[model samples]
Target: MTMRQHAVSDDFLRPDSINAFTDALRGAKYNVDAVLERLGEAGQEGLTRNQTMPALDRLGDATDAQADLIRLFPLQQIVPRSRLAAFLDVPALIEAGVLGAIGREGIHADIDVRPYGFTDAAGEWSGWVAADPIPGMDSIVTRTRPNYVLGVSPASTSLAQLTVPDRVGSALDLGAGCGVQSLHLARHADTVTLTDINPRALDMARLTLALNGLDLDVRAGSFYEPVAHDSFDLIVTNPPYVMSPPTDAADRLVYREGGFAGDGLVRHVVREGASHLA
Candidate 1:
C-alpha cells in the first residue's frame, strides 16, 4: 500500500537537510529569550493573549535576521527578499519548505515557527515549534478556514509541566499537533509515536520533530485507530476539549472541535485512550 505524503512532499525529509534548516534557524538566534527580548515587556505580554501587533511595532524596520524571521513567522508579516536573505539563505529555506516567496512582497513563512522553552526536573529545554497559526482574538470571528492546525499554546505547556517525569519504553502522543508533547516525550521515552486525524497536523508534527533532530513514528489516524491492538508504556494527549453549542460556523476548525458533541471528544478520549496505554 502506498502512504500519502504530507506537506511539500518528502524531498526535504533527509537528515542533512533538516540539520541545515536547524542550523539556519539557530544562527539567526530564534529562541524564547531572544523573542522576548525583541518584543519588550508589553509585546511579550500581548503574545500570551495571541496578539502580535505590539511585537510587530517594536520590530519595525529592523532588518536583522532574527527580526526578519519574527516578522515573517509569528507576526505573519511579509518581508522583503533582500532583508530575509540577510539572516537566512532564502533559496535553501525555500527548498526546505520553510519559506515561500510572495510576489514582490519578498518572503513569508510557509508555516508558523516559534521558540518554545520549559523547565523540568531534567532542567530546561528549548526549541522551535511549527504549526498553523492560531485564530487570533481579533480575527477569530472572521476565520473561515477549517482544519487549522494549532501552534504552541498554554495548554501544551501546562500538560508538559503537569506530566510525571517517569522514564518509559515507549510513548504515544495522540492528536500530536505540531508534535510538542511528542517532542517532550522523546526525552523520556525510548520511542515516541505521534498520531493525528488531520493529515496536516501529522505533516507539521513530522517537520517539528525533524527540525529538532528528533525522530518518531508519525501516523495518520483518528485517536487510537493508528495503533489498533497495540499499547505503549505511556500515552499523552490534549484532545480537543472545547465546550460550545454547535453552529454552522464557516470555519470548522478541527484543532478546536473534535467532531463529536461538545466535550464528548474529551469523554471519548478518557474512555478509550486507556486501551492504548500499557
Candidate 2:
C-alpha cells in the first residue's frame, strides 16, 4: 500500500483499534509528565515556548520506544517502524489515519496527539487530545487550513482551570475545539455533549475521547443547533474569541476565528447558550 499517500478518513476510528492505541500510549508512558521527564528542564522550557529544537535535541540519542513515540508525536519527527511497533499498533494507527507511513522503514503521526492532564474537584485526570498537524511541527504546511482544529492553547488551559467543578446531570461544550473542555466536563457531568461547526474539529474531538478510553456525544453544527431541544444542568463554552477583522478567506481558522465582526460571535454564543441550560 502507498502508506505515504494517505487521506485521513473515519475508517481509523475502529473501537478495538482505538482501545489498543490507548493501551500502547499508556504502556509507553506517553503523558504530560512523560514529556517533562523525556525532555529535561531546559528541553521542557523550550517546548513550552513552541521551540521544539531543544526537546528534539534531547531525544536525538534516545532509542527507546517511548522516545520514538515522543519524536513521532510531540516533535513531529519520523520514526523507524520497528521501534514504534514495539509499543504501538502501527498498522491499526496507520489505518485509523492517526499515523501515516513515510518511507518503507519510517512512520509519522498524521495528527497532533497531545497528553492533556489537569486537576479539578472531580480529581486528577489525564487524556489524549488530537488535532490537525501543527504547522510548526510539520514541514508540509506553511499555514493552517481554514478548518484547522487547534490543539491545546492558553485559552483552553485557562478556561479549564476556571470551570466549576460541581457534578451535573448533563453538560454541554458549546464550541468544542479538540474537545479539551469536554474532557473536563465529562469528569463532573453524567453526560457531555460536544458541538462544533467545523467537520474536522468534530473528528478530532472523537479521537481525543477515544484515545482517553472515554466516549460522549460529539455533534456538528453551530452553537445550540445540534442540541437544540436538549437541556443541560451545566454548560460551558471555550469559543473562538480571537475577534479578528472580518474575513471569509481560507486563511480564517475555524478553531479560533468566530467569523463575526468584533465581539458579535461572543455575544451570540452567550445569548443563545443561556436558553440551553436547565
Q: Point to the candidate with the largest lDDT.
A: 2
* Candidate 2 wrongly placed segments (more than 4 Å): 1-11, 138-141
Q: What is model 1's C-alpha RMSD?
A: 3.2
Q: Report the C-alpha lDDT of model 1 over 161-247, residue by residue, as the tens digit.
A: 777769999898989988999878988899998999888888888888877888789999998999998889888888886687245
Scored against the true structure, residue 111 in model 1 reaches a CA lDDT of 76
Query: What is candidate 2's CA lDDT for residue 242?
Result: 76
Runs in model 1 lying further than 4 Å from the true structure: 1-5, 137-144, 244-251
lDDT of 1: 0.79
Alpha-carbon TM-score of each model against the true structure: 0.89, 0.91
